[model samples]
Target: MEVTHAVEFLLLVLLEKLSWSDTKVVLPDANVTCIIPEDCILPCSFKPTSTVVIHWYKQQIPVHSYYYNKDQFGLQNKHFSGRTCLFNSHIPHGNASLLLRRVKVQDRGRYKCYTSTRKHNQEMFVNLEVKGQCAAMVLAPVYLGLATFTASADCFYLFAPAQLWVVERAPIQTVTITMTDEWVTCSSQNVYPVPQISWATNPPSSQHAIENSTIRTTDHKGLFTVESMVRIVGNLTSYTYLCSFKSADKTQVWTASWKNQEDLTYEEGHPVLIPCNAPQMLRNFSLTWTFTSSSEPTLILRYDNRTRHTVNQWEGQAELDQDLVLLGDGSLLLKKPNSQDHSGTYTCTFTAVNTKRIFQTNVNITVAATSVDEQSMQRSWWSTAASAVFVLFTVIVALLQCVKQNAKENRTASHRHNGTGVIEGGLLLYMDLNPSAVRVRPHGAGAHEQESSLVTGPDHCDRTLEPSPEAEQEEEPAEPAEEANEEQRDRFECNEPV
Candidate 1:
């Protein structure tokens, strides 16, 4: 038994030496991008000789401790005890990958993967990046609790926490306070950190909401929908309202308006039809058209009811029909199309006796040219000609049928000749009328004698005519003969032999 154990030990040592010789460790390049609060993985793997030990480090600091042979290092790293783990449980198979759970902005940094073997030690590195979650941006007065917000990216993680500040301009005061999910609401009676705060929301306008004099924080399970209002101090004044939010790291996304914004659609060069009918006559109205390139709109046309005339880059090309007594339908017509007019918003404004309204439309246009080959053109032309030929053939057939019917009647009349009726002004005269007869000549006594003799004269002559079988018939159809006789008599009565 001792000898057998010695042999097995030697074999195991040989295998370990072979594994160390073939060991290869690699890691993906660092500097990756990840949205805030999103989970990410930093891949790592290595091979080892006899005994293997794997460890995960964060920026050279010990993160997850794994002692393959000892099984004790894994219990020491408290922060990574439950959050970090190896990809495969069977370490003998040479899988040294690490998996991270619930990543945060603090997780955005360099990570190290290390492996130790009987022969040597190997290590690899990975870098993580965190990005903001929401695409919707808002800007508002610095009052404590006046707006509730949610972002597009749900993976956001709280980083450094967020703080509200009261910024002010001379003559105007601004105040803001940090809020928690539990106390999302504020009232006029409850004071806040920010008071006497007011600013105009119209960008350069200075209007603000007064903040209550209280500091609140809560560890809520989910996001909070903030409700806020402004108590105007001193007197009621007109001020624009702005709403804004910051990322976990205080990054501004974008801002939208509480008021209705216009979406204009139009095409370049085509006349944009702006039909206007106001309840009140627009005596104080002015019409304007603008061109937007990139994202900024530039004025191109303007009209005022006072001036009764409009000015525009497309001035002469524009036509407007206006009526004063009753609100006339103000229609603007544009002539001559071009690509520069292809995209942008066209707006029209009309001010009536009491109310002023503005309307906007957007236009987009595309143009293209096409080319055809010679073969296709030839095919099309020939196809048309073929149809014409077919129609002509049908017409000719119909005409020929009519001519044939008339000729047949003339032939039947000629066969019932009485006193050798003259063949004049007949369609058969123009045709090879007698298909069976070789010629027509005056039949005298000698001509009849020659025809009879010729039949008996030469062997070259076929029987001159076959005797009609009806000639030997004991009875004949009396009706047809009688009708023929009547027709012959009628003809004789019309023209007697001269």
Candidate 2:
């Protein structure tokens, strides 16, 4: 009887173990993406027939717990002490989600949530992915050989591989008469899921086709470094050349281009029109006109398929025809072109919609001075001469009038000698005669009578004097007496005295 009882006890224990294994917990694996220094939720839930106990663990380390209708985190890990919390309110509804705050790089791993009910036990798992910030550096093109250039950039990511690309440009590369072959290289370093590179040209050429080569290298941190090179063997006659770098998944692409030169000429005072029409019209495009000279490149105008923008210096002097633009003519018109400084090279760049290709046209303009400028200069000289002659004539007239007035004043002052005697030939003479003091005197009169008889002079030295009536009568009587005395004296001289 003892042996039979032992066998039955062993069978009962085996049967209980088999029944527990048959009731497997239905928990699915999940993935969650979270940024560094932010919060995340590790989701887990189970259907419980009664009150349950929930616990969250990070890689077998206890992070948080929930029991007795509240969060019980006494046995939480040190790394997740104040940063872990369980949803206590959802405990009765069989939810055991864990909220992690201020997630750090070390928090990236697997997590598990375990729940225990009165009837069964269950658990769930979650995978966490943390992404940190990254940086990229693009270097300017370096000339490797004659007509050969290389463009490169370095990109790095913290946790995972980064999407990278390379932009190649030839801002001012020209092929001289002595050069034979030309080459351009575009490269990207420390990238994952390697990028694609291609080349294009305006007025596409077959003789100057692109030949590509790539080299893959690895860093100490297991990052990828891809170096791409493109070579052009024969002569290039295209107006523009383009190079593009695209990722394998086609989510990111970078591009650059080079342009050839053209010449244009215009005369001063005439309107200047620059043609910039593309061969094919796209639904959306961008057109920019830039003036390049000794100074910095000035932006003249920009048309972004929607609106037209004119720069400050070119506001009133430059304009675009909207009607012509609608008809696929992207031209710039300058009115009254007068500045010699405007004679320089101009660049017109066009970017199409939904593509990485760029088309650039360079127009070298020369403005010659017109005949109108010469005529204006001559007229200005004539006006200046006329003004100078008029001013000189007015000065001469004023000087003459001043001299005549001074001479007249001096003559009047000399004639009217105000109380001072006149000086003539070094002799002072008193010529102020009294009119009442002038009288005529007889020849043989007494001294007193002679003194009383005064002589009168003429009114002026240049005029003749006339006699008065009294003087005429006295002269007649004197003449008759002279006649009678002469007759008696001739007859008897001594006897007439007795």
Candidate 3:
């Protein structure tokens, strides 16, 4: 009898829609799943003729937890602000689906839709699943990253989900969204076979494509750099973009492809291993590391089956363990992650042996820890060293250029300035060694050049007096002498004949 009852309940449990006929309230049950850093919209509708109040709530501890409505809890939860919006512009007499702007893992909960009519009250349940979206979203997660993603509605009913690729701002690949009853999937495996996202364009510098390329661009606090590079507010902030290549045949290729939806939290000084992989069996693969400080790709290191030192500060310290196996379960290990490694996308590339089959994975790491005094001191030393080296290089180059320019200027001046010119700085080609003359144009002066006029002291302009040698001598006295003389002289000594 119990088995029959369960079977009967399963057979009778059918997905249905709500109606607003005759001032009666009816509810429907639906389930929704979204990934973190992605957007999800709840589909809902109501009959246009019913005069009812619709409310949405997150059902968990409290009996009543309203999220969206004209009033009430709408003003309470700040997280839902600008994130929850009504799908239909005409809500009173049209669809009332709620659109959650950016979904997070914590947002997974049971959502209730209530419609209170003049005569009856009805409700619906929306089961939400907030899983990490694409491998990219899990690997390199950011809010608002999920935009303009729509999969075939029919995919939701299929068993084998199709890949849904999100191509925003022409992301160099065609992405298709295929859904299945169990899950929705997104893939960027060149559905249409486009060129890889140019690392040159990633940091977006005017640079060429290279195996290991890095670009550095300062992202101002309020400035948008990548998609819509706009300065909404202030000066630029610094960010690094790394461009690398990986192959499918490299050892530990799967580790690179596996992306984590959750943020990796770490304590200070401890090394963390990030899984990296090749597209195929990890056998023939080449890995490189690069860093971007600003609009330029600073090459760090390239794996030539042998480790090579790079000019990048971080890459110089990078070392790959030869004894460790990178095939089948490919992984990249960092010796020690410091606060300096806090923000940036770490790219791992794999290349097939003697083939062009390359696979790549990007992992964004955030390091949060208090640095030890020694580590801080070491960081300061390295920072100072790098700054000093850069400054020295700049100064040396500038001095050399100045010297070369000075020689050129000396030659040019020898030809132009027969007796008076001296080389002051390099490359001042347009500068006048001996400025001929500057004519001061009086207020409201005409456009044409005017004849030179003598500039006199304020009291003597256009006013001439009889020659008084003593007074004339006093005119050009030193400032201190003038002050002393003024103090020594009597106040009424200069008496005007009345």
Candidate 4:
């Protein structure tokens, strides 16, 4: 009976220890699969304490530990030497996570966390699964380093693998909403490892068509110097562009991405990648994509995961990946999505096992306004100048016509003034009345004045006569009297000659 009671007491003590070790860590029941050769973090938390003591174990073997306000890893396993760490600053905040660097296949196991402090203590467990070396997912993983990308919308597209440890579901890190002539530059200097540069365009352009052109050269100090000059905004154009720099050794990386507005924008005349996120891991799915450009909705693309079939009504303008459809990414590939051909609202309806997800993206594709050709402007200016010259010439011709008409009128007036007969008749009337205005005659008598009537000159002399208004009106007899006067003047001159 004594042996039985002792066995029962020992069993009770073991039960108490097991119950006390059961702790709360991040994703207690979930298995976190870490990609090989990358750093992995096993998270843990405890009650806050200034005097912190943390111990990590794998099958009762010490992996890492910290005590007396300092890391005392002398008791850590040699297999994990220099590969484990506890964030010292986070200890006071109840974080007792372990960072395992350069993960290997042997590192895959269930880990136990034992934490202690002056006031409280806690414990937890973390199971890390290791994936095959270089076994990458079909969905491309963005390995961001020490780089900055401004104005890119393709940043939030990193989806976690199906039911695995999520490294990072990517999110937008940077964006630049700038006007024309704005130069977005990403450069780095005095770096040890040679750097690689690339650009991520909104429409997913080819390498040749990307805007970020990075120039790289090694300096004398064996450090890499890299510079990228994103050229001027070709037009008053809006496009989501990103420039990323990564170290060749994959140690340091920088990635920057941004969106122009809350609504998405696509590049005109360039093939674009329209992003769609599935609600969950789809096993058997039916996908439908409807596009509304200006009117009624039309089905542009449809796919079935069960049959591995695709229907595209866009006439080879739309593309899809059936392999990636099973995963979380259901992004559509559009060829030359332009305002003329692809401007609209796109709706992606993904129906799968236990999930019906709908993703929508408004594509506002703006084609760069065609520049007014300089040659055409020159032609227009020449046309305008020619029109002005033509108008001036017409005015000059009109003025010349006026001058000729005035000269003809003046000549006609002079001819009429000189050839009028009424003026001659008026002169004859003056001779009949007072002839002094035309010819004047005075009487000069001599010795023969009594014999010769010529000396008296009663008819040769121009006499001043007083005529009534009625006699002056009769212009008929005045002309004959003028003729007789002329004959008498001729006789007078002949007789008076020496």
Candidate 5:
């Protein structure tokens, strides 16, 4: 037993030496992007060696492990069940990357990949960041100037903590020319750090030449909305106007011009192309398209020197002519125009990369209903005509039924009159003197039982009339005068002879 214990101790020491010998520590930091419920790979590799053992850990928790020529999942964390995997075939090549499936929010953390072999050991570190799902940006148009310029844009982010900076944007900016004064008003909303607004006139005017008014309001979100107005005191012939919104640092400025405005029209269902030609002199300039109608204006698209971004609602609907955009033809192609909503004014803005000068052009779009809508309208008219004819036929049939029922009632009344005897001049003149008893029948008595008699003697025929069950069930009560008249007629007939 002593010898056996001695041999076992020697074998353990040998195993320890084999585990620690030639251990190479390789600590490299890696960055990985992981979206929720998607798979991500944490990369870690080392020099190939024999009989490899790999382990992946999140902080101190065991995520996954590979040992004894197979994957050892029994020691994996419960949160990673059925979601952790490693490339077993690559193990021989010293590639021990951990593949995490269905990534959760909790999966964001520092990860360590430790690999060991009979002669070598190495480890690598990785940082995982979980982000939300990605989506495309949508753009609308914002309208500016008298010629109906509109501009709009849609923006989306691939990760959280996004930021938006509008150098100068206004939803309700307008210029009006009146008999007395020329006025220009500009308004912007949802801005941060309190932007500044100013006005400049062409041919250079003094500060006293224009009257200015400004208002600013802030919301609970700590963003600002501003409105600025400028009026030329007297009737001015023709002067150019510019409105500018400058950043607090004065490094970035947005300008709106009143001189460069144009009008355009297009039919529905057809594509529209608004031309924005740029001179060869302009370089490193950005182009933006906006739409403005009777409703609010919106940003449609923005093309910086490199890429084109489409704003909300206009994604996939608006696109720049890629081949011609760089050539200074910043024309936009609008697909399948809708008359009710798309008919509005569009604006194209060009800003130089280094200069504060801005150029703008306006296009008015008019979309009418297509031939399909007209066909549907025609079908509606035919359906209305058919319904009218059916109603007229139903009314005519109802009238014919009423006329037939009235004619039958008139015939019945005439027959009843013919069956009754009339007393002349309100005098009961006995035509028959037979001393027979007269029987008076009720109103609903059968016609075959009807009898007429006359009795001239002093003894009169006596009888009482009782309403039948059917007559008692009637909702309306009979008049007393009619019953009395009936009784008098009975008495007069009874006094005469039958």
Candidate 6:
């Protein structure tokens, strides 16, 4: 062997010149940030000698210690009291940096640094990050992520592309609150999360808020249905609502409250109840009664648990209280109250199973202002008895038309005071020939001997025919109509028959 290969190459060169003092595994340093209150500088260095010793731990607490010649906090950490320090002449140029002031936010973590000098003891670590300060603001609408922000006022919108973002803000978004109730419609279904509805008023109208018409589909199948409503119109002021239906990560919650606070007059046509209360001996409840006057919200009435049935959409105006409605008194009845269609805003709701209830009212009918002056004195005594029965029917039709025109001028002055040619059964002999006679025949043969031979010379036709004292004073006021026309001209012996 060549001297055994030169003694195995000098024993592999004496084990590569034997000098082992480094197990080798380093990796720490990298993180070190600071901003909470400000200051932080945890770097360090060593390897200079003159007996320079340094220490700075943060796990076993004591942070910052320099040997004998200076800076040595008494086991420091009264939360880094008076905030740590160093750079003391840069620790004689070996620079065992620390500084730390103000920082707090638990000052972050991992920081070791232990350096010593009597020959070898350097440690390092580093990782003390404390961040979250951001305030020099300039983001009006700047989100490098989510999106969709159609705001109206107070804002906190967006989240999509890293999510997306854009924001703008002012304030008020319809806050006029005297809230007599304008919203209450919770819902839920196939629930895998998604729920949130709230409205409060127990004495809190501060900042105003309560106007949601939400309708996540009256929600069903999996469960949910809360309803609340109110409207007393005009001189409004009746509040005390409180509704909450949570579980959108809220873990769960349910609440309901109500109030009506009086102002329900009546008189106009009388018949109103508008009161409600339910939840005492409940029996599978479900009731509703909405009327919201002007803006249309009608659901007049509905009941659904008396074995299921009852709906009164205003036919008969509306009613409820079927024997005290399950003893919880859901009173409502507006029979005739018509103040131009029953004043307005009724709202009554009472559901069961995980319950909910709502009720509100404001009626004021008035109009029977008593007898109003006795109905205007009975309408002026019926217009003076209809003007005295129309003046006695116009004086009995002018005394029966002046006794039928003075009995037709006394039968034409006794047929001209005795002018002849008359026959009762002789067909028709009405003659005074020249006195405008009018005779007609057809009474049977010889018509009374042809009317007695044409009224037979009539003794020159009866010389007893005397009249003329101005026609007997115009037939003396129609003396019995001239004795019945002189007994009809002596039985038509001849006389007047024009």
Specify the highest-TM-score model's number. Answer: 2
In model 3, which range of ten residues has the least summed lDDT? 227-236
Question: Candidate 5 residues 1-498, lDDT tens each?
Answer: 657655744653355346655657878699998866579999999777778777788996778877778886655678999999888888788789999997866688899887777667777899998754533333443433322211223121212223222222222222222122456666566654455778777756777775567888955333467777888533343455666777554555666554343556777677877666654445777787788778777888878765544343487677787777777787778887667767776766666642323334444445455676898899999999999999999999999999999999999866654535334443323232232432233233222222233342466434333333443334134453455545545654454322
The TM-score measured for candidate 1 stands at 0.26
Question: Candidate 3 local accuracy as lDDT?
Answer: 0.42
lDDT of 3 by residue, 388-463 (tens): 9999999999999999999998898677755332333311122233344212221222222111222345654443
Report model 5's TM-score to 2 decimal places: 0.32
List candidate 3 segments past 4 Å from native: 1-28, 49-51, 60-74, 134-498
Q: Rank the candidates by lDDT, best first.
A: 5, 4, 6, 2, 1, 3
Best by lDDT: 5
lDDT of 1 by residue, 289-393 (tens): 565557777776666767667676766766665553134455556665445654555555554432234444454443322213466777889999999999999
Each model's lDDT comes to 0.45, 0.58, 0.42, 0.60, 0.61, 0.59
Model 2 spans with C-alpha error above 4 angstroms: 1-32, 35-192, 207-238, 250-258, 307-313, 352-498
lDDT of 4 at 332: 84
Q: For all candidates, what are the clash counts?
A: 37, 2, 43, 7, 50, 13
Angstrom error at residue 313, model 2: 5.3
Give candidate 4 regions above 4 Å deviation: 1-268, 321-326, 337-341, 365-368, 371-498
Order the numbered candidates by TM-score, best leading.
2, 5, 4, 6, 1, 3
| Candidate number with the higher lDDT (2 or 5) | 5
Better of 1 and 3 by lDDT: 1
Question: What is candidate 2's CA lDDT for residue 254?
Answer: 61
Q: Which parts of model 6 have CA positions greater than 4 angstroms off?
A: 1-184, 187-193, 196-244, 248-252, 256-266, 269-342, 347-357, 360-384, 387-391, 398-400, 418-498
Select the stronger candidate by lDDT from 1 and 4. Answer: 4
lDDT of 5: 0.61
